[model samples]
Target chain A: MKSYFVLIFVAVFMPVAMLAYSIVPKRLRGYVLLVFSYAFLMIMSGRPVVYLVAATLITYVTGLTMGHFQARRDAQLAEVKKGKKAIKEACKRTNRWVMVAGILLNLGMLFALNYLGFFAQVGSGLLSLFGIDKTFEPPLWIAPMGISFYTLMAVSYLVDVYRETVKPDRNLGRLALYLSFFPHIMEGPIARYSEIAQGTWEGNPINRQNLYTGFMRIAVGFAKKLIVADRLNLFVDPVFDDFSLVNGGIIALAAVLYTIQLYCDFSGCMDVAIGLGCIFNVSYPENFRQPFFSLTTSEFWQRWHITLGSWFKDYVYYPVSLSKRVKRLTTMARKRFGNKYGPLLVSSIALFCVWFLNGLWHGAGSQYLFFGMYYFVLIWLGGLIDPLARSLATKYGIDRDSKPYRLMRRVRTLLFVFVGELFFRANDLPSGLAMFKRIFTHFSLETILNGKIFNIGMDPADFIIAGIFIALVFARDYAYEHDHNLLAMISGKNAVIRWAAWIAIVMAVVIFGAYGHGYIPVDPMYAQF
Target chain B: MRDQIIEILEDINPDADYETCTTLIDDRYLDSLSMVSLVAELEDTFDITIPAVEVTANNFNSVDAITKLVERLVEEDED
Candidate 1:
């Protein structure tokens, strides 16, 4: 009940839900999904499920209202040739207001539930700075499960409707199911209305091909979670929790391990989510695209948590950067600085907003903000330096696209990512800074030289197991990066090979998974956010 | 108009074969920063408002796509 990986959910709840969904008539299948979605939400967050309902209702009403105005506008346009411009302008203005109101309402709820307390604490701290003794008692709010995921989806849907990219769903139940489909409710690919809503509503029966592919994908997710991520957690958690006890070398190693742990854990969960969606004949968008293979920080964001990045790009970045005021600034700056640096200067304003909100969206924490700013600075600097770098390479007769150069860039990007994740995983901004400082100031190889590395939570055997699995995962990602779809390749193979692959995955998880005796199963990492 | 659009693309990022490359965005030839510069240049050059909604792959993925988008927006501006 707590997470998708739990035995109760995996063994009991999913089987029952799938059975019920399969047995239900085609006409009632969507309702069945709606019912289970709500039931899952209720079990997870109880009364807070009301917030999801409120969001769905607000989105539904907003869409219909805009639709109504659009209809009227079209009718009037059809009836008249003169004054059509004025009529269209009037309707556009009204719909804009309606869309803005809907967006604000949805975002307002999210802010109250997730961010109010953090902001209040900051407010109180500022007050005390001026010799004020009074403190504002922030409300304790239990956010509904997947509030972050769903709210973004809700806003995307609303905006898409306003943009006429997606027609508003008049069917409340369909919209409800789109928002609350149990698989994506927890950690989402932040699916758009246009992406999977129709397929979801169609409720196509679970054909054998889909079922096999879905189960195979789920098995891969389980293998990733059980074997690699959980095992690494044993070493990663304690180091982060008690970072001060370890030297810089160990701290550095821990950071690298932590980044791997996080990728596996988060992407593994996404695999399960998408697999479940596949079982139900809905294809959730891919969230991770071999993020480790990216060569630049900007490219890394494009690859990692892809939906979230694209969400910000479509909703926040493009809008802010292309707004009238920013566009005017861009024009002015471009005139002054020329084509390369001018628009970039203005675009930085929009980039700053994206990173600032991106940080806050993770959680109301200073470290998260710092993490966002870290990437922002790196990306902006990269943009600023790219032209110079390219010119220098040309002047020096260096091949920027050569494998060595690409490898160097990938390593550099990974180093940057490791540091960012250090801040992201640290207790706070100060702790992150302290740990980072130690990496350079208190550097040492004594931990490895003295055989102390193995003593810190993970033995040599643990390392071997984790290393083997990590390599396997890396190979799979490498194949994917090269356009080799492992699943498809397997699916197209003979029964013996397919069955062997499945059995190997299952046997690996059952045998080498970091559970049972002393291992603590890590909760789905991205679920908290 | 098409030639002017190609000039803008060349100025933005001359690495690609704009005449034949249709995967400018898809292949990362036109990164986000490049997209921003391209949009601003196109707007200033054409004297048309390119709203954020029009900044999709279908509109900016190639020389032909960018030419069509600018022409369409220019037409809309006239209307």
Candidate 2:
């Protein structure tokens, strides 16, 4: 598998790497980059070259239609510039067709790649009742690599262009590169065209400073991934894979470990990506934001997956809220339903759309969808009671921003996030729900102490190491939030202290990092995006 | 129309823009999210729907510009 990945990586990355180093025109560089990104992606999907062709075609057509729409509008606007308002009404209609077409094209790939199997299952199940099954399975089930990540990027790109947040790329090649940039092709921090357009198109040179930073980050990431996260998984997988064999205490610990494993694995991938981008002289947005330190799930969102969370908030939630239909509904609700439930009913629809898409982005499964809605319901409920919470705090003469309230909120958010991850980590939907129910049913602490799954590997010392790691996480989060400048401050101290901090982080990974033989190499979870 | 638009702009960004339109939407003085919120509030305050097309810089450039756009939209709806 490692060799296969190496072969695929060389096949996909070597050309792009060369292009990055090539003295060719910067703008045309995006063309080579786009071709290789998709080609590499298709080749990685093995024999499913058709899926790649289909996604590329869909995205290509969508961008062309969008650009065409923009051009037509520019022409009409110029004609109107000569002071002719007579045919402007017709121009508006034409522009609307373009917007509709853009949306259709962007959404077309989403349905084709992600939802086809889901709809088939539902349709076949419905048909079976009448013995009218029509079989539909495309033989090339090698699932389009990076379909989920790039699809969102494409949708947001078109949406951004339509909204004029950014200009419509007239060149289809630049647009394709924006969608399929290889380092970001698989799991992404989901770069927006607006964010990277100037940097990606203009150019940044590869300096030793950037090179060292990139490699250092990759090393740190690999350490977190191999030594810290994967090693801990030896204890976690059994507890989660078959919870029937474990007790509540064990399950609870597994949930927390899974959280750590996910963070290490995911943020580690971001480190690698950001590092890779560093080598290319582009800076991608940081996805994880010391999430555990968040005072509310809302705040947690602001910290964790900041790009994706904001993407939904900006494109979906805010737009739906301001839409004419929603405003009208809100007005009607306000007059009839009063302030009591007016905003709730109106925002719930918008919130549900964001959450539903959020869930579906994780996987092509109901469980992931449930995981997203899980936070949606929790956050919405929290939002609903905000006024009441403030008033109650006032009556009690307590500060809402005080440490205690913040601590309580943080605890609440952690619990909320943890429960959502429980569902997300489960093998399947039913198993996830059943495992959840087992939390209430089979309550015992003995399983954790008895080492039910330690037979797989992991010692008492490993648990302690995990605990120490978790503590370090919290400490680092607090420092980050408070802007402790601990490292900078300490580096100012005796050289002994500064170098010690560096050595500690490095040596810990070197000695304890999980790698080599009988160990499952866990890929970055976010990479599946 | 100028005064009404000024009132809305004041609510969103009070420190600047008492004169010519400031390209409020295009300049992104109010970010996309906050701009949407502002739009919803303005529609409620002034009784109009900012059409998707009307959301461009040609109309939303400044207080006076937005006020004129809103008046035009409202008049068209009334018709």
Best by TM-score: 1
Q: Write the per-residue lDDT of candidate 2 for residues B9-69, one digit (tens) a residue.
A: 6755554556864766544454333344456666777777775435555666677777788
User: In model 2, how large is the Cα lDDT of residue A251?
Assistant: 76
Those runs of model 1 whose alpha carbons end farther than 4 Å from true positions after fitting are A46-48
- Provide the lDDT at A96 for model 1: 93
Candidate 1 residue lDDT tens string, A63-85 = 99999998898999999988888
Steric overlap count per candidate: 0, 5
Error of 2 at B29 (Å): 17
Residue lDDT tens for model 2, A1-529: 2211133353556535755555666656655556666666666555444544555566556556666756776687776555344455555456557666756765676677667787787678788889996866743443466777776777777677666667766656566666676667767878888776555555456675566566556555666676667877887787777788777777777787788788877777777677777766778888877888776676677677877887887678867876778878877875776544565667788888988999887777878888888888876776667546766877999877688888888898888778878889988789888888888788787755677545645777666776676576567667877878554465466656655755776677666666566667665666565
Clashing pairs in 1: none
Error of 2 at A188 (Å): 0.4
For model 2, the stretches where C-alpha displacement exceeds 4 angstroms are: A1-44, A47-61, A79-92, A127-140, A338-341, A450-453, A484-508, B1-39, B48-79
